[model samples]
Target: MHGCFWHRHPGCPKATTPATRPEWWQRKFDGNVERDRQQMDRLIAAGWRVGIVWECALGRKADGALIDRVEAFIRHGRDLRAEWP
Candidate 1:
């Protein structure tokens, strides 16, 4: 699964959230998103396949893109598969 590391385990060695202030954390999250976008673009430009797994896409819902998420994973062999609580 491909996703911002922070969203996976915030404060993990591979992830982090700004701690100086709450707003800093928000900016940090935004930066992570932008960085992830750039990384995807770079990977695509390099001819590598990229699949995104968003934190919110894992929920079962009456009206949602859950099927799309499954299809993406099945067809692409990758996903931003975050196990949200």
Candidate 2:
């Protein structure tokens, strides 16, 4: 299931962001990104699908439906790669 069960605490050391008192926003953010990468790596290695649901996507805006995006990713992720023009 692509590490889908490996949920972390959003901002914890393993997930949650550092509390205001710690004042380690940048470090925590970087760590979070890195951990996400590692999770992807492990998932890929295990031959599973990985779908990342960003926090901001939950709200209505330019991105639109979170479910739609996730569905599209799941349906097309394997055959997809970034293209820059």
By lDDT, who's the top model here? Answer: 1
Per-model TM-score versus the true fold: 0.44, 0.49
Record all residue pairs in model 2 with backbone atoms less than 3 Å apart, i.e. clashing: 10-15, 11-15, 11-16, 11-17, 12-15, 12-16
lDDT of 2 by residue, 1-85 (tens): 1121234334323334445755567565566568877877787788777665544334356444555666677777673321110
The per-prediction CA RMSD against the true structure, in angstroms, equals 8.4, 7.9
List, residue by residue over 1-85, the lDDT tens digit for candidate 1. 4443554444345455455796977777777767776887788688666655544434465434665555655587553332322
lDDT of 1 at 14: 46
Off by over 4 Å in 2: 1-23, 60-65, 75-85
Worst 10 residues of 1 by lDDT: 76-85
TM-score, predicted candidate 1 vs. hidden true structure: 0.44
Q: Compare the candidates by TM-score and give the number of the best one.
A: 2
Global lDDT of model 1? 0.56
